[model samples]
Target: MRITEPYTIFLRRLPSGKSVYYYQFRDEDGKRSPAYSTGTNKIAQARRVCQRLYNEGKFKKSNEILFKTFASGFFDDESDFCKWKEVNGSSLAKSTIASYKRLLENQILPFFGSMKLKKINTDTVKRWIVWCSEKCSAKTSNNAQSVFNIIMKSAKEKKLISEVPSSELAFRKIKKKERELLTVEELNRIYHSPLWGWECARRAFLTCAITGMRIGEITGLQTFEVGDDRLNVEHTLHPKFGLGPTKTRVCRFVPIPKSLGLKRQCGKTWAFEKPTEEKPCRADYIYGKLMLICDSLGIDHKARGITVHSLRNMFISYMRGSSFGETIDLKIKAVVGHADESMTDWYTYWKPEMFPEIYEIQEKLFKEITEV
Candidate 1:
């Protein structure tokens, strides 16, 4: 039996012999919502919830806002959502905001842009998920799904929707591919080669190889942070956000051989500044030089997925497996600023002189590369 005057209530029975109460209510425009769960088995409680929500005008509120219009101001500093996040002490970085905006424009808005927030439901979101799988890689599809959920959750928090559409399905799984890392011989070749005339980028790549600095860290490295035998890492350069905190937001001091010949200045001048300009060189520029060197040396750069980041991977692998760095995994993590909370105490009390093996390892590793 169905009660159809003010609203309709029904019980859906599961195979396990449990019944759930669901309801459908009409809006001001006479549009009925998809059956929403009251999350109770008791019909009396379900009726009270439905009546209370309808009286509060939640049934009519969702009709006025379009998904695209609401999403347009999602991360803007002036938006209520941004203010709410700030008040709660969870403000997102500009780079993260930019990434979310790209996902909205490219993946989300194309399908949901014209749809009403009220009309977005589980089936609709599932269809979008299938579409994303067909169009994007598994990882990228997952990112799109995550961003959409965040938007729906925000809408629900603001009372724009009764509840966020549940994508209860698991995100698509990505098959992990083994990234190609530079070998000792290949590294020696790269170190000795001219790097297609990109001297500064070559230095940056070598720094990452020996000290395990990320390309972004190299881009943001300041002259004052360098010392006679070690460099302090405090910030990283985002392509769009410029200088900001490192990826893990943890600062580290890494030992480097003085033979690397990195010079220190008084203030915050970039250590890897372009010769022609005072600005830090682009990561893409460094990557391009690496690709060019790989080509010139007959290395399978593209087929093997080699890139500038391979330098850091090489460093980590060598340090973790080498005899000198065998028992110092925690120190290795501290040196590279790996994000592990269990090692926080070790990272806190770190000093360059505390780990003499790393200096010896550095000296042996860079001895060939630094020699003329």
Candidate 2:
């Protein structure tokens, strides 16, 4: 049926004696199409449902339509929305920007990128979801939709459209993957094991496992940021993005409980300095190289959930001491930098000397309760 064709609606009484709404329309062959249920008892919502369906269905196109009048940009790479933020001296994370570009290149562009902004609505989104379903898993398709939603939401913010196209959109269920953490013994086994030839990588991993700092924080750590019994997560570095903000987009301190004695006092200032040379490695480097050591240790990284970041998982699991409530009782949040501590405090009263006192009880609790 041509989407632009006129549609008519009527009410039908169900066996339960409740009335429901449905819409009927004509097809391209001048044939009457079957009545489609709007699935709502409310007439207003039902009309919205019918309108949304019409917006998404196959429709006639005009070759005379101007492309420039449709949308200022089509794909993620073309958006140039980053320029808006760059002018403000701040920009969205490169990882998020990359995800948008990847989603557009891989899936979103094929279905909706070329379509006019006026043509993109909930109904077309449903068709796009179904189209993505043909090639990828439900989760990946949903991720693509999320990326599309972000782009549309950006357009809405810029006043390109009256509203976000997918504001009312809902996606199919996404199955969760099972993620397991290593036990304390398994952690020790890996920590003490040979570095499979690279020295700093193992130490970097073990520091994350014991202290619960993110891998990026550990890899990009400067020796000055290391203390007698705590590691400072002041910055993180990425391969493509270069040295940048942490996942939380702020500097934080992660406790290095005296139990591990992760001393970074050495020739180089940065932790895990160039593994083969004398320069510090980026966060991505640590994430990329660990699988080789995993192979050497005869560990199946995927089966074991043993990425460099999973070392933080191991730290978290061991910190809780087999009880969920202990996480709060032990104040594990502050130790792991999960505390809602203000970044403003950095300017207010940030002293590396003051942390040892502020975290005094945490240090004792960590050494007392930590499994390893």
Best by TM-score: 1
Could you estimate the TM-score for every candidate? 0.74, 0.65
As a TM-score, model 1 comes out at 0.74
Worst 10 residues of 2 by lDDT: 58-67
Candidate 1, after superposition: displacement of residue 146 in Å?
2.1
Q: Give residue 84's error in model 1 in angstroms.
A: 4.1
> Residues 212-302, candidate 1, lDDT per residue (tens digit)?
8889888888888888788899988888888887777667788888777787432347788787777886788888888888888999987
- Give the deviation of candidate 2 from the true structure as CA RMSD: 15.1
Candidate 2 per-residue C-alpha lDDT over 1-372 given as tens digits, one digit per residue, 9 for 90 to 100: 655545778999989998889888654454566676666789898887667545544211222122232222433332346665667765667775776667777887777656676667777888888889898899778888887787777656645566776778788887765677665555555656555346666667666666777776676787777776667687676666666667766666665656555574432667677655667765655666667656766778889667777876656665565444363433465556564645533445444454443245445434443335
Worst 10 residues of 1 by lDDT: 260-269
Point to the candidate with the largest lDDT: 1
The residue pairs found clashing in candidate 1 are: none
Error of 1 at 133 (Å): 0.6
